[model samples]
Target: MALIRSILFNLLFFPGTAIHCFGVLAVSPMGSGPVQAIVHSWSRMHYWLLRHVMGISFEWEGKLPAGPYLIAVKHESMVEAIDTLRFADTPVVVLKRELADIPVFGRVTRRYGVIPVDRDAGATALRQMMSLAKQAVVDRRPVIIFPEGTRVPRGARPQLRPGFAGLYRMLGLPVVPIAVDSGRVWPRGFVKRSGTIHFRVGEIIPPGLKREEVEARVHAAINALNLPTT
Candidate 1:
């Protein structure tokens, strides 16, 4: 049953995505707003299909932070990434460098102002990311980054990558850490089971703390979602 549902979802998902992608391409020259609308529409459609077709729903606690602040999220599945668009008007997401060059889809990432991290370039990459992210802040857009750098399985706790702290200090913006348990239901790749995904928003971690202090707070806050609750 799960296999059939997953297959059905993919069939429905890609066609809708193609249509939105073309719409975004047609109107991207207008500005980021139109591009973002297309993206947001796609996100809503994706989540709607997840619920109605696959029996997967979301339980979100806590409000989304105001714009121009950093949103440090727990990356456990692609669901959280897509849902970020649902939170803010047009969030500036930090993604890997490769994703920005994927043929037709790459244009969407570039037009939407996604920060691409070249992990291999080390400090150079960090500087470039900071430059782009600063512009997002100035534009009053919320920035969403997965502090761990990559998705992890449910209950696996990993220290945040160095760049997260760097951005926090350099951007000089309050960071709102969000914890999610989406992976428990939608593990990476094609398989998505029927379950309720929870997004627990933590308190705002203000700027100007030491690197160690900031990392500790963000790490602990995000990992709290993974803790076992009877």
Candidate 2:
């Protein structure tokens, strides 16, 4: 069943990739509103295809926070990234700089207000990320970030990067922690698998908390979600 599903998913990828490419071209000159709307629709379509092709299911716990908040999500599999877009309500993504250089993908990402960070450049990227995050908040858009910096294997714990702290400090908005077991199903790399993906959206950690305190609280929330179910 898994092999069949994988083959079906591979077949679907071609058309989905074409739609994404055309969507990117359609939005390149104007990066706002209609463009973002089109990209969001295409993204959801891609996820829908993925879910059907792979026989994967998801369960999201807790409510999405109201108003502007910094969403710090666990980074485990690429599936989580696509799921984020599929599930969220047009969020402004905070992504790595390398993605911005990709041909079609880059254009679509920029159109959707994805703030790209140069991970190798250190402080400069951090500062720019914070600036873009603040603006997003002011624009009443949620800022989604993967605080773990990079994707890690299933059940492997990666240290949360300091850049998250900087964004939290600079934005001074509520931080919502999201934890998920996406790796269990999709794992890493490009191969597809079949299973349920569990996502737990922790409470919104309000502003005015100390950086370390917020970090610790969010970390604990995600860790708690990562634990065995039974």
Candidate 3:
């Protein structure tokens, strides 16, 4: 039954996503609003498919920061990344540079002004990412980054990657770490399970701390959310 549900969801999802992306490109040229409209619509469609087809739902705890704050989010599944549009009004999501090669999806992300980080390029990639992120901040858009660099399955506790600390210090913006348990239901490889995915926003960690302090604080805050309740 789960397999059937996952299959049906994917059948609907891929075409639906492509249509929305093309529609956004046609109707609203060079605007984040329409690009975000594409994101918002797709998020709604995804959750609806999850609920109706896969018997899954989601909820959020704690409010997302109201203004131009930097957000370091828990990377657990693709669901949280897409649902970011639901949290902020067209946030600048820092994602892998390779995504830019994905045909139409690449074009849409470029339109959305997403920050792409190239991991293999080391310092050069970090510089490129930070430069774009700074411009996004100056434009008064909130920035979202996955501190762990990539998705970690439920219960896997990887250290926060280096790019996060660099961005935190260089951007000079207050950081709000967000945690979510989306992987429990929406695992990385696409077999969707039934459960409520929870997103919990952590307290704002003030800027200007040493790299060690910032890393320690943000790491604890984010990982704390992944732990089972006492």
Best by TM-score: 1
Rank candidates, TM-score, best first: 1, 3, 2
Alpha carbon lDDT of residue 126, candidate 1?
75
Angstrom error at residue 156, model 3: 0.9
Q: Write one digit per residue (lDDT tens) for candidate 1, span 77-113.
A: 8788888887766899999988888876778888877
Residue-level error in angstroms, candidate 2, position 111: 1.7
Select the stronger candidate by TM-score from 1 and 2: 1
Off by over 4 Å in 1: 228-230
Off by over 4 Å in 2: 27-31, 228-230
Give residue 8's lDDT in candidate 3 (0 to 100).
94
- Reference-based lDDT, residue 48, model 1: 88
Alpha-carbon TM-score of each model against the true structure: 0.95, 0.91, 0.92
Local accuracy of candidate 3 as per-residue lDDT tens digits, 1-230: 77788899899989999998897788665566667777778778876887888888777778876777889888888887887876686689989888866888887787878998887787777778888988988888899998988988887778889888888888899999888887777776756777787877888999999998988888877776686422
Evaluated against the true structure, the overall lDDT of model 3 is: 0.82
lDDT of candidates 1 onward, in order: 0.87, 0.78, 0.82
Off by over 4 Å in 3: 28-30, 228-230
Whole-model lDDT for model 1 versus the true structure? 0.87
**CA shift of 166, model 3, Å:** 1.0
